[model samples]
Target: MIRSGVLQITLREESATTRIPARPDCLLGAGRQSNAIDRGDVDRTLRRWGASFRTSLVFAARRSLGHIGSQHIGYDDTERSLGMSRTYRVELGDVARARDALSAVRDLAAVAQARIESLATTHDPARSHPSTDTRVDAAMNAHDLIRATPALAREQGDERIVVAVVDTGVALGHPELRRKLLAGYDTVDLGLGKVGGMELVGDSRGADFTPRDDVGHGSHVAGVVAAQGFRLSPGMAGRSLCLPVRVLAAARPSGSRRTIGVGALSDIDCGIKVACDLGAKVINMSFGTSEAHIDAGAPPPHREVVDYAVARGVVLVAAMGNSGQAEKLFPAAIDPVIAVAAVDERFEVSSFSTRGKHVTLAAPGERILSLDRHGYRLSTGTSHAAPFVAGVAALLCARARRRGVELGTREVRDILVRSAQARPADGHRDDIGHGVLDADAALRTLDADLSASPHGRTHTHG
Candidate 1:
């Protein structure tokens, strides 16, 4: 029987002779053929290798894909044409056994790929603490730098425009964020029993509807996007709604005072797909893994779901990482996603912000004021910088909808890049991409485009 560790396996499409059974216990029962293995063979193989069937990784998506068209902010013909592949999860006793099983699974003709689920963490730097001074003026100055005030004056954003914060999870009861958050999902699945030496999930056991934040990173990121300005602190998109999808959980390593946000790639992929299916117009991913951490020749993680989200007309924003190096990071480095780097109040790129060709824009991420579980606090990282762009993307989508136009992922990215204000001395550099994010300029460009286009026609950039 399956005991501890988890591994994800993707089966070949052509080998399938039967559909994946609805029962969670059923393991790779895709059918029997000259080349393909049946359910009995799958069970015997796993049992022989000291592993067992856990669950289907793409089962939820398969069930929900057909129903996504009925959701609010429905997809167009392009989105409906995309298809999902069959992937499954299995449990093993130890890391060595898990690795062996992965190798064995790869030999099977039906298996396309197999991997030990990798973990991703939030972009917050080590030992980063929140500033005690939580004043409104400091937050407003950062917002003003990006001309968010003027952009909000033009369009305060729409409740219909949802920006999914796919991070740890948000504080559901935070006064500043309660009204702005929509129902979210949690995809953290740490098998039936904990894997030895990899107890990353602090309190989270498995998937659930309640996405409460045990760690504060997700709450802070969510606040940047849609926190309601209380007494002094102002939210970037006050009218926009934040959908909190919990993929990362709190994990405090040995001798560390702070809990780092950690999550498996399987959960993250599921979270992204869920957010897209749930009608999120924009998704802010504030976590990443540096290129150094990835093994050579490994497939880029989250490629499928990122493509799925983009095809469905959802604008994606991701942190450029805080490694202080010119390294590539997944999801962010992947094309179609708008990668954002950290900039300080002076519009200088943060020392910690990773520089790469994929970076699309810069946002205030140094000592920036945002929300925490306890109350408002100031933190710094590309994690916070990403949400600022996400908040702005939500506003752009709202403005487009108000003008009776639909903005796709490419259109939104084009507007953000075109209207970005270049730094005077540095010009467009690798660290900051086009330049610092200018909310007012982007909205104004969108307005001009809609004005130039015929009424009721969708305007897209070449």
Candidate 2:
């Protein structure tokens, strides 16, 4: 993950530094680009601009090249790489020089960013193949566990659970999520742009960005977690509130032809931080880098950040990924994260959902109902399966809070796993994790906890 907080590049120091005063534009759009950042290209970029000119903004300098384009430069973020990176609009003694520097900085920075992004995708396996099949909604195990319709409706549906969808931006005005959105943040934009600007920046298509569902991925996942009004059948009708965080904007059409991979590690890390910072108890992550083999030591870089979030008492759920093999996806693959694998209506694992030792839970990923700008659509993917767990996690959180229990990630996991209906393949299979999540079973577990407590005081665990 990119870590939390903003990385501001200032042109001037406090006292003697000349301020170029310009808004920093995200060349890659509103979120992290899933593509790889080419190391060879970055090397070539630095070499092309040989001879160290006045790079420090704390001191005065002149604009060397006014081709008026920006360059994307990556520093080691270490002692050696510090203060060497050049940015746009330093106090080149005047505005023209500042403008030229700013332009140059933007241009070159774009090039460098492209290179770095290429490297970013190299480590992941999810982006290896391109697909045109839209996401489908899978059935929930609620039917088998609930038994009765009215009771299920009364006990399960009305419980308002807040799920934070940390991915590309959500369509805030979408009828399903608009009502339930308790709070939201752009994280990448710092909430600076106007309502329309939000979409424009998030779409990553320049000034003409629209918040509509360009790619149905985020909306599909969000709808599963907390769509406002839904009807799976006769008695299945309910909705949950969704908090949309636009981490990945639209990709540049020419740059990425197939999929738009914007949500970067930094964007994801920042999104999680924002969700935690906003007091969101449940976080849903449908996207991941690559899948690792089982028995691997610790998790990758992105997984570590997720662990930190889980430590803070937030329930994090992620997609097992769509590789159709026994591999572990980051964030989902992490021990703390509830990795969700997708199963179809037949109760068979989806061909796209990855399987491995880290698979902790399973959900219906085929023909699942969700909302999009076009209307309700049947979607499929482990991505959709994750939000189902997130919704269940929120319900659990609500029950815990109602009973006055200070729950952490571990305690939450314990309750959920214990409540689940043990399956035949749970103990050893690399496919389904435990089994498909049972909402009614989870609720019953909370009921048991509340009954055991003294005067409604729940227990705590680390």
Candidate 3:
């Protein structure tokens, strides 16, 4: 449930008793996500006990949740970021009952920050950052941004580096993404089954059973990361084995295609774990929402989600966001995840790219053309920018693995930031981080690092 939100209280324990170990103290909310409560058990144990407290309200709440299809809760055994706790979602009629339940739930500890009302709005740490005009685009062009010709000349592709795109599901038929796919999962089915309270419209093939991309966003982003680019920039194509982990639902109807929809935190958490388990060396996150900075002391919702991926040696990359404002958003604002901002053809920071110190690098994002369902099409937003960086990271990872050089997140991020062509603006660096993304330049940096290290491999860090 949104109320007790800290990466879902996942407790790992198998007790002999029929009762579960970790559970919420109260039940006054609409949804809860826990691995511990199965539908059969919840209907038998929780609903039965809940009815006794407030027969009418409990019955009504269950019925309402059922109508919205909340019964299709999600489960992921691979996610261990928060304490191992089974996910559960249920509605409770009374706060008093919540208190009483908390008192008796000896195995679980309730934290004040988990309340839903208190966490409704979120904040971006760098939104208020003062604007600064800069010449970073020139810096990237001087170093060859997006032109992967040189990198490919050295090595055709890195089969070992798995790059995962955890966004809306991807359209596998897109010619640009044919070889880029590894089997992916659909997390939208794990959600409340509604977008902004409206019943979902896309997924005619039933994405719940097989992941499919009704929205083209995921496929477009995947193009930037690893599209063969047969019809687009073929020489600049990325060849990392792409993993599409669909988290958002395809809700908006746009003729033959559906548009991206809002995603719940549970979907993202599940996607991150699946990506890591599937051997994703690089993961791209292209979605985010603004949060109120007033709650600075409160932990942001997705902090632990980002941390979990980083802890597992996954090189996480996130979009700086398309808000066109300075304040930074989640995942991108998180320290370990490399935040990428967008730049245009002229190498100027995109007007829509989010600006902030948290951004690690800049990439071509303004109306840049990439793969689409029918052919190549023009698209914009930090969504495209982040994948460019992800593609470069995967390319470098591929080359490193071939040379017997194992690299970690810190080593890869350092290479991109340090090798970037400096974009000095008015005597200081602007919000676009170090500069524009240069695929060839980053690979050269990786090669140099390997040569300098012992036995032709970069130093590893846990």
Question: What is residue 126's positional error in candidate 2, in angstroms?
Answer: 13
Q: Which stretches of candidate 1 lie over 4 Å from their true place?
A: 1-4, 17-53, 62-85, 137-140, 191-202, 295-298, 423-428, 454-462
Tens digits of per-residue lDDT for model 2, 14-133: 111222211112322322221111233322333233211112111111121111212122222321122213222111223223323333433543332111110011111333222333
By lDDT, the best candidate is 1
TM-score of each: 0.86, 0.63, 0.72
lDDT of 1 by residue, 155-238 (tens): 888899988999989889999886788988777654433332334545556545577887889988988888777743456765
RMSD of each: 5.2, 11.5, 9.3
Candidate 2 has an lDDT of: 0.50
lDDT of each: 0.72, 0.50, 0.57
TM-score of 2: 0.63
Q: State the weakest 10-residue window (summed lDDT) of model 3.
A: 54-63
Task: Order candidates by lDDT, high to low.
Answer: 1, 3, 2
lDDT tens readout by residue for model 3, 110-172: 322221211111111222111222233312231145556776776566667788888876777
Better of 1 and 2 by lDDT: 1
